[model samples]
Target chain A: MKKAFLSTGLLLITILILPLFISPFLVYLSTEILVFAIFAMSLGLIMGFGGMPSLGHCALFGLGAYTVAILSEYTANIYLLLGAAILISLCFSIVTGYIAIRNKGVFFLMITLAFTQVLFLITSRMKFWGGNDGYSASVTANFGFGEITSNMGLFYMMGFFFVLSYFLLKLFVNAPAGKVLKGMMENEGRMIALGYNPKTYKMIAYLIAGSMAGLAGGLYIYKTQFVSPALFSVHMGAEVMIMVFIGGLGTVFGPALGAGAFVFLQNYISTMTDRWPLILGLLFIAIVLLKRGGILHLIQFVTTFGLKLFKPSRSRNAPVDKQVKGKEQAS
Target chain B: MIELKEVHSYYGHSHILHGVNLKVNKGQCVALLGRNGAGKTTTIHSIAGLVVPKEGAIAFKDKELIGKTPNHISKAGVGLVPQGRRVFSSLTVKENLLIAERKSTSSEKQWTIEEIYQLFPILKEREENMGNELSGGQQQMLAIGRALLLNPDFLLMDEPSEGLAPVIIEQIKNIILDVKKTGLSMLIVEQNIDLACCVADEVIILNKGEVVWQGLPNELLHNEELLKVHLGV
Candidate 1:
């Protein structure tokens, strides 16, 4: 109950207050942060819950971006643009998930990485895929509902997607099959012994995660109006891992928080100095050492401590004394 | 009935089983008695399609089962409770059973959720507890209940009593007998010779991955010298 209250309060504050005060540059950055948060959360659903760490999620993300970029270039219809991207991503996710799920742990990770790298090379070399120069993305015509080509309007769309994606992820983890995936992570042998074939369930999770990453990519193309080969880079995979860890591995809200903090750090540092990667490297280590779990745990600690200091045991004086007296009598 | 003939197996190049043969007739409780690393578990795995047999044939009711997947073998009415009680640790007792609830192949005798809970009453009480929350004995019972829910004609149990309390072991033996009364044949791998001799009708002794002796439980019990030679009991 307390958690729900806190989260809702934070949500209201972020929705109403932050955009009012923060500069447009920071808002733009926040928008990027939220998009990446969706991406990170999707990957974490597989890594943290399903115990399948993927190094090829960028492939799915890039696929989504390219799909949108390609379709939007040819077609002005918004629904068609989104439809093509989603369908393409879903197909890629299914195929990638099938081959990857056949292996366990490190092998699964390696095979996924191989698939992504192959995809990267394909995108870099193919002529129709725009080769290494990449493709120019175009915005949809709003289906004759006037041009929705404004930055603020696009921000709201991205924010809505972020919220939708987050809730969908929560629903999945709470479902019966999702619980089985968690069980598989804890003890796969036992799940098999129970006669619940985990392979099928895990494959479904991988596909879902991949498709979400793709959806995020599709939104990313809409926001930026460009799609590039670097979207599938190895560095993007590492950034995703960092995002999940920074947010707090399994918490629902952690991914968004991590994305906000991380993207802000990158933007702020890049403006101040060219040593942003160096700064990120140091912060990553400190977070691992200090928070252990992630920034989410640190935030939780601070919230509780701040509450305790402000209240200062004022409500418990009479009840506490009575409890002490009662204990004394019992003794 | 199930038969494994001249089966050989290896674990990453180390030969584990060499020329091992065993059979269990329908409605019989057969036990494989061996010390650690005696290929008893390996033999069960081979039959369950978990491990591939290099030079042998496994026939279940005279049907070839060598090249099939684990699910196919399971579908063929061969249920295995593996060496460790590998109950899904995050699932509740009820969820564990529900997850693997396959309808009985025969149209007339489907194993329902209530029937599984009836076989193990403790499961009904702890239906909502996570798999790891159960006691060692409870986990063992859950494992057996899980396999039985598949309604297999034959059950292969590997070390179901290991690490369990004696009282729990007795419960397991009783459950085995109760299952036996229902005409489900079992291949039991056990180091507990006393429990094996009690629950099993026939005992097959494996030594160094080779079958050294096979006889009635009474005859095997009477011959202590042979038991010591093969089983190191």
Candidate 2:
């Protein structure tokens, strides 16, 4: 309990302090990272604990955004739009997860990818959804149920959702069903042999993960006041996966850091080169080769080095366990 | 308590079991003995619904099992301790037991975490350790403990003594006999002929997907030439 308090306190400090030092552009970028962070965390719940490698998270995200877009087009009430988005997105995710989770591993991945790819193609060509041009939501204070058109409000909402997501997911992973899902990941055959069905656990995980992604997506579209097919692209799915991998998955908030680092690098480097993708690809190769764990890992490595240099003799009195505290090689 | 009649199963194009038949009365300890390539595992898999039979009927207390999925079959009260003792490696011993839980049907339930701990006290000691960290004997204990938590009436244990030390195997054999006192029926698939002969209420020998012999353990002992001729060990 003490550890949890300290972690939350540290998170609160970062949330309060980071915006003060950074420019509004960086604030906006980090807000974008917050949305991605929520998405990646949702994906990690299934991939890391539920053992379902879902590549169709963006489908759920896009569905949420499009649901809000279509509803807001018809009705201007912000409360109704938010409610409608949640419901519609949840329904869509449950249906998609049902189809996607029936098969085994790689097949599960392909099925999810296939479903999202189809959605992306339809969004690109469909005129009703604004096609590739995309739909811009109304953002007036009075025009749409006291909608906060200001960027700060949007950032606050994103951050709130990020914190909410982390806690909700933490609650879930500790639940009875969550334990079963983790057990399924460890050994499904044994689970079956022990008189427990693994399929139900998988399906539940898939649906919950889908709903989480949907909530994040809805928040995202509201923040941007825009909806696009790009939200459903394969790239979005890959980006979420990269966040999970880099976040040192299984630890809460790791994916958020991963998303922050990825977005930060992209923002700073794209200013210098038009071919940022190629450079990013090479960097990915280097990360895998270096086995750096992730950007947070790199940060840890450097921080330790700097701390050691600053007080070379201080460690003589300090505890050894404190140095590498909480740093573990995830299985 | 269990019956399989005219059970035929095929793996892809290759036919495995051909018109296999077996039965276990309540509290009966039946052992399915065979050579390495014989259909003992497949027969167990068929009864457990891990493999759908091409043609047959699997009835546990007169309810059909062949058409059901593995989960539904398990829910119907067939607890299988499968080959390889496939314990959930990432889960702790406590968690592995927790996942196979069934709501208590009786006001006085026979099995609880306490009850299972009594059955395999070694599991109680390693409750915090991950399943993979345990030795083979401990894992086998965990596997049995996990199944016992469900409190099923029948257990289908595959290869309980497949690769354990002799002493551990002796302990497991005692555990099996102790469990049988609860009136739980079993269809155990074992390669250990000595252990099988000692406790099995009846022995059924399968030679290549066909049941060639069925009798009491004493009768099986009397027919040692038949066992030597067929089992090859």
Across all candidates, what is each one's fraction of true contacts kept?
0.33, 0.72
Of the true interface contacts, the fraction found in model 1 is: 0.33
| Per-residue accuracy of model 2 over B1-233 as CA lDDT, tens digit each | 88999999999988899889999998899999999878999999998888999898888888888888787777777888877788888778987787776754621235888888888998999998998999999999988887777777788999999889999999999999998887888899988988998879999999889999999988877776977888875
lDDT of each: 0.82, 0.80
Give the lDDT of residue A99 in candidate 2: 82
What DockQ does predicted model 2 obtain?
0.50
- DockQ by candidate, in order: 0.28, 0.50
Worst 10 residues of 2 chain B by lDDT: B101-110
